[model samples]
Target: MIWSVISLLMPFNLEVMVNQGYLAERSGYWGFLLQHPLNSLFEGGLVHLWFLPALMIAVAIMALLIRQQKTHWMLPIAIGLYLYGEFAGSSAVVTGMSAPIYTRNGPFFSTLFVVVGYLIRERHILWQSRSALLLAMLGMAFHFVEAYGLHQYGQVFNTNDYLFGTTLWAIGLFLFLLAKPDLGRKPWGFSLSQSILGFYVSHLLVVIMMMNLARFLGLAGLEKDTLVLFGTLLTTYLLVKGLERTPLKHLLFR
Candidate 1:
């Protein structure tokens, strides 16, 4: 909701080409103000905002299946859908078709991981042992190999997330994390946690600003990236901290 409002107020500038010609420049402020909220709701107005809606759709489907006592069907269905999506959606070699509103393979691609998460939670899958951690590392290594091989063969898609290797790696890593002992609460933990959502949402904007700042200062290569990274993080942290004192904090960070 906050993002939708932000999109309406400050829609990111974009350029589109049509008929091998660039669109003529015009004042888009009012048009974007009218369209951005709807775009944010359906068409991923700010690109990163796509995650929320896609995850919502995926979770809603899973919840429905669970409510109907059909949990057993979820894994098979999710796996099948993921495979189909990999072969026929967005970066597919066959169709190369994607839903414009959701952007490149949205809920269908996300559903697989969501289902995996659900299974891990409900089934108590654990990976605390040394052997499990070793296996997880091996799985990640194999996924890297698989991705490289696919890229070499020109069969790789938009991302490795659709591949079985990635699924294995994700599951292994998640289990490994789950097996770790919890860190006891710290004095700054609550404040840090509250700032995370704001940080995630605002960091991209900070990075863009920092990129221009770096360029303006004539920084290049790794130095520029490092400066941008730390600069954005620090700026976002401070911004979140300051916003926390205002009533609008909940709208931005919640």
Candidate 2:
């Protein structure tokens, strides 16, 4: 959240779409706020960077509901919101037009997924890793099927992010990870994971630079993609590692 504020003030040179925001939303700091004064409440502070704020909202609501012992209402409400999101997103495919609203934000997705996690935890749910993996694969297959169907409808946009298949996919993969909690307990894993926050917030800077350099050098195909991907990861990881040793560590998490 704090880092994004920097981009709003300075000419961060980010293409407006970097946030997956409408072009009209681009403006100087004050103008940006004036354009969508309640943006953080709706699409988040920025659309592409919506996860943290969404997660925060979900957690806050869950905390309140859980304390009141009235969390059972969440599942039904979540279903309603999820259906609305799916309807809005999928209607675009059928109508050959943009959806009337973006429903991938806090109320639609974050609240639902967070409630699911809470229920799983509170109920002490468990699953076999093999079965979880099979479920994951099945969910992925369903997602592809849905995507292909939408493509046949002549929709040029990307896959819908909040389909039923996607929910199943998340549940299965999450259970799989929970079943193997020790997977990332190794020294190397600890070292690599320590700078996750730093990498996430700063990697795009290194990535866009590498992307342009790759294009300028006439790099193409998988080679160019591999270079851009790994180059950004290594560069950002090193920068984060260095920053971890400095005063900026106060601003960013370990």
Candidate 3:
């Protein structure tokens, strides 16, 4: 749950991931929250407001009430609203109701994926069939096509993210479908959480250093954008290596 909340808050201001084009739009939400933690409790301007955190708080309260009453369905509904509401609304709201499929918000809808992951842990479902594997492969094909399309289209990328979303949903939903069998393995191959830490902290370090370098270089136009990307990855590797030996290791992995 702590990780879930942290993941939920990640996109609101991930200056690092935004450059990587992960959840750029959702940065507005996280940014607003970070800038005005109090105002975020209420509302804001025409852009991002407090509705999301409000909803989260509301869900928390409802969950408490349900817990007091010992209800089960509320858990699913609470989790579902947190998941689906964010899933459906993030892409919709971010792109002004145009692209309804991209997972460019936060980990809201991804929360469902995590839950399915938990189910995999409990039920041992992925080994039952190869359908999920086939779906994942197909979805990857489409995801690549859509990403390539975005790269080709360039500035018009926002208008075409729906294709990206469709592909992601195909892959994501298929993954969920196969969750029952594939996710609950006893001896996992690698540590996803560790990888996330390395990626997250390293990425943030890169973004910060790149931003500072860009300001110093005064590199305007396409050169600036290109440099930022290059600098981010370079710094990421350097920071990842440096952090491995620091006391902050727990901050990344824990």
Candidate 4:
């Protein structure tokens, strides 16, 4: 709701993802959340805001399965749904046809990862750093392999969203982070960690503003993505730091 209101203050309808041309079908949808209203915001209604709805749906599905004592079916069901989502959304890479609905905005992507996280906690699974690193490396390698296959044989040069390796990569990375609880305990590290969510939900507005400013200043070459990335980080960091000391932090940032 905050984003719905706050995002409107930016020139987001003129975002790169919408005007970039590749995601034309997606643009009519929102460029990204380019969008409906509060009821369907989860279906990419507010672009980056899609995660909230996806997460809620995935968790609700997981809860239902748990309540029914169908815990064993979670992983399998999640995998099946993920496959359906990948093919449904990225089929253009093979059949040259796009699905009517953006499958990524559906429960397909979030379910498996959510189920995996719950299972790890419910089953008390633990991973050593070395083992987790190996899995992470393997997942990274699988991504390269999948990209190669898509370029060589699939209809497109790049695959949409997730390849099979995507889930594996995410799980491995999550586990790696879990295995290192104290890895980022330094003052700067802790500060950055705390400000992550702040950066995430606020960065789009900053980027949009930055891009518009760059264009106005004829600083296109200078404000390329790398520059924009650092600029957004710096801007958000300052705002987050100040907000952390205020009451509005609870509502707008914290």
Candidate 2's TM-score: 0.80
lDDT of each: 0.67, 0.72, 0.50, 0.73
| Per-prediction TM-score to the true structure, in the order listed | 0.76, 0.80, 0.47, 0.80
Clashing pairs in 4: 30-34, 33-45, 33-47
Off by over 4 Å in 4: 13-40, 43-45, 95-98, 153-159, 223-226
Candidate 3 wrongly placed segments (more than 4 Å): 1-75, 82-110, 127-130, 137-195, 251-253
Ranking by lDDT: 4, 2, 1, 3
Which residue window of length 10 is worst by lDDT in model 2? 6-15
Segments in model 2 whose C-alpha atoms lie over 4 Å from true places: 9-47, 95-101, 215-223
* Model 2: per-residue Cα lDDT at residue 241: 92
lDDT of model number 1: 0.67
Write candidate 4's Cα lDDT for 114-227 as tens digits.
999998887878799888888888988887777677776553645357777877788888888899988877998876877777877777777776676566566766457666
Worst 10 residues of 3 by lDDT: 42-51
lDDT of 4 at 72: 90
Model 3 alpha-carbon miss at residue 50, Å: 14
Task: In angstroms, give how far residue 175 of model 1 lies from its true place.
Answer: 1.3
- Residues 1-254 of candidate 1: C-alpha lDDT, one tens digit per residue: 67645644442332222222322212354445345454455534355666677788789889999999999989888887777665554335444654433233356667888999988888888876565667767777876776676676565534655555666767776777787746435768876876777876777766766876786688999999899989998998888789889998877877
